[model samples]
Target: MDKAKEIFKVTKKTLLLIAGLVWSFAGFRVFTIGLEDIINYRGNKFISILVGSVVFYIFFKFIFLKMYKKHFIRITTSGLDKQYFFQFFDLKSYFIMGFMITLGILVRASRIFNPVGVANFYIGLGFALFLSGVLFFISFSNTKKIKVQ
Candidate 1:
């Protein structure tokens, strides 16, 4: 029974990871198209990343604070030997989340202004968010002795 439960948990988590990848890939292509049309200046890209971080942070507040806060406490205490916690949610994750969210939101908002790149951005952002959820699960699994999700 325990084996079956473990198998089910792994399967569910794997499915979520795969789903996240597929959604993000599809959305990113659409976002690229939207950016080509709406982004008049390169500076907007950086601003978008910062905005994405805040957006992603807000979106996951519940899980981050309520469910996974203890993991963070452990990581901070674990020191360098267990630094994978830091690595799992490393700089790359943040930048990717930022870029994807920015592009997706830009796409959605541009619908009002009728920019060429606007629609794709929203689709992409939605998918990027899906991926972020998967990453959260992955990060959590890595830090905890048992599957917390």
Candidate 2:
């Protein structure tokens, strides 16, 4: 059983890489979708894009950056030699992710808000997520250096 469990476990470095890749890919996909929606918007395109850019900057600085730091500390402080593959994110994170995904899908499908408005929000969110992923990669690289030294 231990050997079987080991097959599904991964080192912290690998967890970091996996988290980075997953977040980056999801961010890119969401960002592109927002971009496409904004392109199709008939309103003031420049202002819409500008608003989205501002949102991105604010969220990246205030929210996602802090989240990255917290999670980075958590990962570095964990005592486990290896962890389950899905343990890259804590339980709270998994719940939050699931909720956000469900809400996003429902909102989009129901057209509860203007598509352009949603696009702006998505753009900001996506960029923040992408930046967080980049932070993870940076930490991962630093860990590699630590191991080498």
Best by TM-score: 2
Model 1: residues >4 Å from true position, as ranges? Answer: 1-10, 39-113, 116-149
Pairs clashing in candidate 1?
Answer: 34-117, 104-121, 104-125, 107-118
Each prediction's whole-model lDDT (CA): 0.45, 0.82
List runs of model 2 lying over 4 Å from the truth: 145-149
Model 1, span 1-149: residue lDDT tens: 86654443333233334434544464456546545544654456655555545544564464333323443333334433323212333465458657866865665566665453343333344334454545545654664342333
Candidate 2 overall lDDT versus native:
0.82
Poorest 10 consecutive residues by lDDT, candidate 1: 79-88
Q: C-alpha displacement of 82 in model 1, angstroms?
A: 31
Candidate 1 Cα lDDT to native: 0.45
Give the TM-score (vs. native) of candidate 2.
0.91
- Give one digit per residue, the lDDT tens place, for model 2 in 1-149: 88998999887788888888878887877788888999888889888878888989998999778877877777666787677878778899889889988998999999979899999988988988898898888878878622211
